[model samples]
Target: MTKDQKDNLFLLVKSLTKSEKRQFKLYVGRLGVNQDSKFLSVFNVLDKMKVYSESLILKSTDVKKQQLANVKAHLYKQILISLKLNPSHQNIRSQIREQLDFASILYHKGLYKQSLKILDKAKELAIVNEEKNLAFEIVELEKIIEAQYITRSISNRADYLTVQAKELSELNVITSKLSNLSLQLYSIILKTGYVKNEEESKAVTKYFNDRLPKLELSKLGFREKLWLYKAHLWYSFLMQDFLNCYKYALKWVDLFYDNPKMINLNPVFFLKGNNYLLEALYFIKNKPKFINKLDEFYTVVNQSDFPKGENIEALVFLYGNFHKINQYFIDGSFEEGLLLIPQIETELIQFNNKIDAHHKMIFYYKFASLHFGAGNNQECINYLDKIISNKSLSMREDLLCFSRVLNLVAHYEAGLDYHLETLLRSTYKFLIKMNDLHEVQKEMIKFIRGLQDIYPQDIKKEFRKLLEVLKQYEDHPFERRAFLYLDIISWLESKIENKPVGQIVKNKYLEFYA
Candidate 1:
C-alpha cells in the first residue's frame, strides 16, 4: 500500500482543481469509446480516494491486479495531456515551442518555405521573451534549411542568420555563467548559510569572482541582467552586507518593472526580488521602507495580469504572509501577530509539500519570537523546541543556533530553570562547533549564565549593564546580525524597565522614528 502523499498518480488527482478535473473527464469521454475506459475508471477511483490503497483500487475498479499499474500510468499521462492543452497553461513559451515543433515537422515534409516562415516568426517571439536558448535552436534550424535551398539573396540571408546565431550564442553563454554563479551561491546559502568567519568569507569571495564573467552591464539583455543581480545579491547576503543586498535586490526587481512584460512572464523572480529587498530593509530596521516595499509587492502580485499557477501561488503565500507577519514584529505588535499564527499554520499545512523544510522552520522561529514578545515564554519555548528537535533541518545552521539561544531565554522567562544550565552548555557548544560564536552571542550567553549568582536586588542593575554593552554592537557589521535574530537589547530593556518586551520594542521603534 502506497501512502497517498507518496503515490504520484493519487497526489496528482488530489492536486487538480475542480475545473481541471472536469476537463480531464471531458477529455476522456471525447472519444466516446473511452466512456467505459479502464484508465478512466482508475482515475475516478483514485480521484474519490483520500488515501491510495492498491487493494482498494483493485476492488473498486475493473482494472485487474496485474494491469493496475499500467492503467494508472495511462490515466496519469492522459491527465497531464489534458492539463497541457488547457488554456491557462498555454503561455508564450509554450506557444513558441509549439510553433518550433510545427516548423520542424514542416521542414521534414519538404515544405521549406512554410517552415522558414514559421521559424522566422517564432525566432522573433523567442528573442522578445528572452528565450534566447530557444531562439538559438530556431536559428540553427534555419541554417540547416537555408543550406539545402539557396535563396535569391543567399549571401545576405546566410550572413544575417550567422550573425543572429553568434549573438544569441554569446548572450546565452553569458546567461549560463551568471546563472551558474547565482545557483552555486544559492546552494551555499542553503547548505551552510552565510559565511561564518574570515576564512569562509574569503572562500566565497574567491568562488564568486572566479565564476563571474566579465561583461559590460549596458550590453546585457533583461535575462542576463536578472541573473547578474541575483549573483551579486547572493554574494552580498552571504557576506552579511545588508546595504549591498538592498542595492542589488532593488536592481533585480526594477529590471522587471522596466520591462513590464517580463513581470507577468516571470512572476516568481519578481516576487523573490521584492522579498529579498524587504528582507534587507527589515535587517536595517527601516520599517517605513519595508512597509512600502511590502505593499508594492502585494499590489503587483495581486494584479489580474500576473501569471497564475500552483508554484507561483505557493510563493505568493510564502513571501506575502512572511512579510505580513514580519511587519507585526517590526511594530512590536505581538498580540496582534498572534492572531495570524493559526491561519498561517493552517496554510503551512496546506502548502506542506510545496514549501521547503528550511522556510517552515524559519516560520516556527518567527512564531516563537512572537510568543516571546507577548510574554508567553512557555509558548515560545514550545515553538523553539519544534525547531531544535528538527533533526531533518539540514539547511540554515544559523537559524538552528539562534533557535537554541532563544530557547534558553524562553526557558528562563518561563521559570523552567531546571534545564537552563544544560541548555546553556549545549547552545554554547553548538555555536562554537558551528564557528558562529559572535560577540553578541558570547555576551548573551555570559549574561544569562551569570544570572544564577546575581542577587535578586542586583538583577536589574545587571540587565542595565548588559544593555549598555550590547548597544555598542547594534551597528557592528557582523555582530548586529545577532540582534536581527533575538533583539537582546530590547529583551534586556524589558527586564530593567519591568515591562513587557513588546512595550519596550514599541517604545524603541517610536524613538527611532522620532
Candidate 2:
C-alpha cells in the first residue's frame, strides 16, 4: 500500500472506535473487491461511516454531549471535503451529514422548535440506515425539549407569585388567603411528573412554603394538613409562645434555604424581620435575662438583602424597640433617653406616611403616647390630629377616645385649662360622629363633678347636657355605657382627693378601655 493510503486508513481507524474500526475494514474490502461497481461500493462505505459517527455522538453524556454538535460540524466539513474529492459518494454520506449538522446547531442554540424538526429528519435518516439506537436517541431528545418548555412555564408562574405576596404584605394583610390557589396549583404541578424527580419536588416545595405562610392562606382551599401548618404558626404567634414561634419561623427559613430560588422570587425581608421581632418581644416579656438577644434579633434584619428604602416598617420597628430599651435604661438610672429620640421620631414619621389609614391610626396612637411620655405635648397633639383624621373611623374611634382621655389628663397636669376645654369639645364632636354620645356625656359629667370638688362654684348648668344624654341611654344595653360611666366617676373620685382608684375601679376602668 502507498504511504498516503496507509495514513488515510490509519486516520479512519483512529477516528472510529472499536466497533467502527471493524465496520471500516468491511467497507474497505467491499470497495477493493468490487462487490458492486467502484462508485456504488464507495458510496456504501461512506454511508456506513456516517452511521458510525452519529452513533458515537449520541452515546456521549451531558458534559460531552454539549460538545457533540461542534464535533459533528467538524466531521461534516471533512465529509464534504471527501465528497468533493469523489462525487460518487454524494447522495448518501455528504447529504445526510449536512442535514444532521444543521439540526445539532439548532439544538445547541435552544431553538428547540427548529431543532426538533431537524432531529426528525436525522431520525428518518437513521431509520433508513437501520441504526435503531440513533433513532431512539433522537426520540428521547424530543421529550427533553418538551420538559424544558414546561419547566420554564412553571418558573414564570413562581416569579409572579413572589411579586404578589410582597404587594399583599405592604397592604398590611400579610395573612392574605389569595396565595392558597397558587399553592394548590404548585402542588398539582408537582404531582404531574413535570418536576422530574424527588429533588425537584423538594426544590419547589421549599419555595412555596417560605412565602406562602405570610399570606392569608386559610380561605385558600388548601388540604387540611397545609392549613393546619399555617394555623399552628399563627396561633403560636398569638399565644406569645416564642419557642413555638421560633420553631415555625425556622421551619419557614429552612424551606427558603433548601430552595433559594424562592427568595429570588418573593423576597419578604420585613416579614422575616417581624418573625425575629416577635421572638424578641416574647423574650422581653417572659425571659428578661435574655434581653441581650435583642441585638441578635436585629442582626437578621440587617443581614437581609431586601430593599431598605422600601422596608420602612421594619426599620421603624427596630428603632422603636431600641428607643424602648434606652428608656428602660434611662428610667432605671435617672438619665436622659433623648440621645436616640430624634432618630426614633424620624423613623416613626416616615413609617406613618407609608402605611394606609388603618395602620396609620395604630401608629398615630402609639406615637402620641410616646411623645406624651417624652414631655413633647405638641408632638403628641400633632399625632392626635393624624389619629382623628384617619379614614378608618370604625377601627380608630375607640383608640382616639382613649388618647383623648390621656391628652385631657396631661393638659390638666400642665394647668392648660384652654387646651383641656379644646380637647373636651373635640371629644364631644368625635363621640357624636361615632354615635357614642352617652359615653362621652357621662365622661364630661364626671370631669365637671371633679372640677366641682376643686372649686365648689365651678360646677355649672352646661354640664347638665352631658347628664341628660346619659339618662336617655339608661335603659339601653348599657354594658359599654355603664362601664364608661363608672370609668369617669372613678377617675373623678381619685383626682378629687389625691387617692388611688381601688382594684374594683381599676378593673372597671380596664373593662371600659377594652
Return the top candidate by TM-score: 1
lDDT of each: 0.90, 0.46
Report the lDDT tens digits of candidate 1 across residue range 80-196.
999999998898899999999999999999999999999999999999999999999999999999999875545599889999999999999999999999999999988777776
TM-score, every prediction:
0.95, 0.38
Q: What lDDT score goes with residue 427 in model 1? A: 95
Clashes of each: 0, 5
Best by lDDT: 1
Error of 1 at 235 (Å): 1.1
